[model samples]
Target: MTTQSAGEPGEQGGPLGMQIDHVPSEPGGSGTPGPPGPWQPNLVSTPAQKKAAAQAIEDHIEPDTSKAGDHADDETGKAVTAFAPKDGDGWVTSTSLKSAHKTWGDQVKNLMNRLASEKAALRSTGLLFQTTDFGIGTGLRQTSPLDGY
Candidate 1:
């Protein structure tokens, strides 16, 4: 089933359905100010939230996605190997398939490595921000008190 936000006038929602709106007159230039009001931030992530996201990726998403890719890679290898010519006569198709399989396996490995890197970055984010905050607070505390004029 397709899903869309209300009042979007036939706009759909999903990765492929993403739409860009309100292009500025000049590229990358501030054109017009938005309607003045109390603006809420679109993104707000706490240290705990970052940590939890990292945990979820490591514990669930990474494993599930990698498992599917790995299974596909293995199955493809087995199938291609089975179809390969024994006498090495008509080996064109088999060779092509083997090459494609290797390419796909490399892609999957790269994706898994990227996910692992992302997970590591997420795990360290909380500590990095905490240290930054502490340093800022300490610097502020070191300031001399103002005297009455």
Candidate 2:
């Protein structure tokens, strides 16, 4: 379930229920204190997100949560991105951290296992070695030759 916590998947294949609470703001007060820095819009995960997930796993075999994604000064400023959503542009999910880690580990392991089964000729030329990047955003394998190897 989506509500997994590392070792076991929950009954629902996801967290049992998802709820959101917006942080309260003081009356007549802005969220920022200084000028905004370089504007880097949040990189949204497209419907075809399997690729991104694969990349994140390869680049970061173990997510530290402290440095998951891009961290530019946001529009509202105030170091807001540390809580940006893991999937798209929002907030860090309250889902089980344990489950997320296990899931990521399995993905990387499976890819490596598959790579091990490849024919030795191609494997020697640069098959498995070519795909590994020790970085989450770069490890994802490209589906099209048009994309970089």
Candidate 3:
């Protein structure tokens, strides 16, 4: 009683249905050959490109702090600041309002820092698309809950 492998002809219920003529042991195979060399994309950023991207991000965030200050000056903004309690000598002291003000200020600072860090990291390593080019190609169609109308 002898057994035949699937690669052999006349083996009906074997792993491989058809017989494999030959198998190459080389890395690629005995064919046209692999790529001439390693392939690279043309979109990779250079040092200058990375620097420019970082600079652009910095420039964009530069006005954000001032904007935050302006927003804090509004009535609602002042209300947040005024939430802080004043001491007997009229010096603003630790209180819920002071904490709220600190929290808001920290949030704005964190946002700026995060944006700058993300920009730097992304610039160092090129991204599929720049931050600004995200929504360029899109249809103008708008949908809402009242779609039937």
The top-ranked prediction according to lDDT is 1
Candidate 2, which segments miss by more than 4 Å at Cα?
1-95, 119-149
Q: On lDDT, who's better, 1 or 3?
A: 1
The sequence of per-residue lDDT tens digits that candidate 3 reaches over residues 44-74 is 6676777777777778665766586558746
Kindly give the stretch of ten consecutive residues in candidate 1 with the minimal lDDT sum. Answer: 11-20
Tens-digit per-residue lDDT, 35-146, candidate 1:
4334534577877887888899889988998898888878887877777888755567678888888888788888889888998998898788889999999988774556
* lDDT-best of 2 and 3: 3
List lDDT for all candidates, in order: 0.76, 0.43, 0.61
Clashes of each: 0, 13, 0
Clashing pairs in 3: none
Between candidates 1 and 2, the one scoring higher on TM-score is 1
How much lDDT does candidate 1 score? 0.76
**lDDT, candidate 2, 1-149, per-residue tens:** 22334545456464444435444243333534434334534564343353445555445643432233212112223333444465676554323443455565566566555533432333243333444533444646546777665
Looking at model 3, report the run of 10 residues with the lowest lDDT sum: 32-41
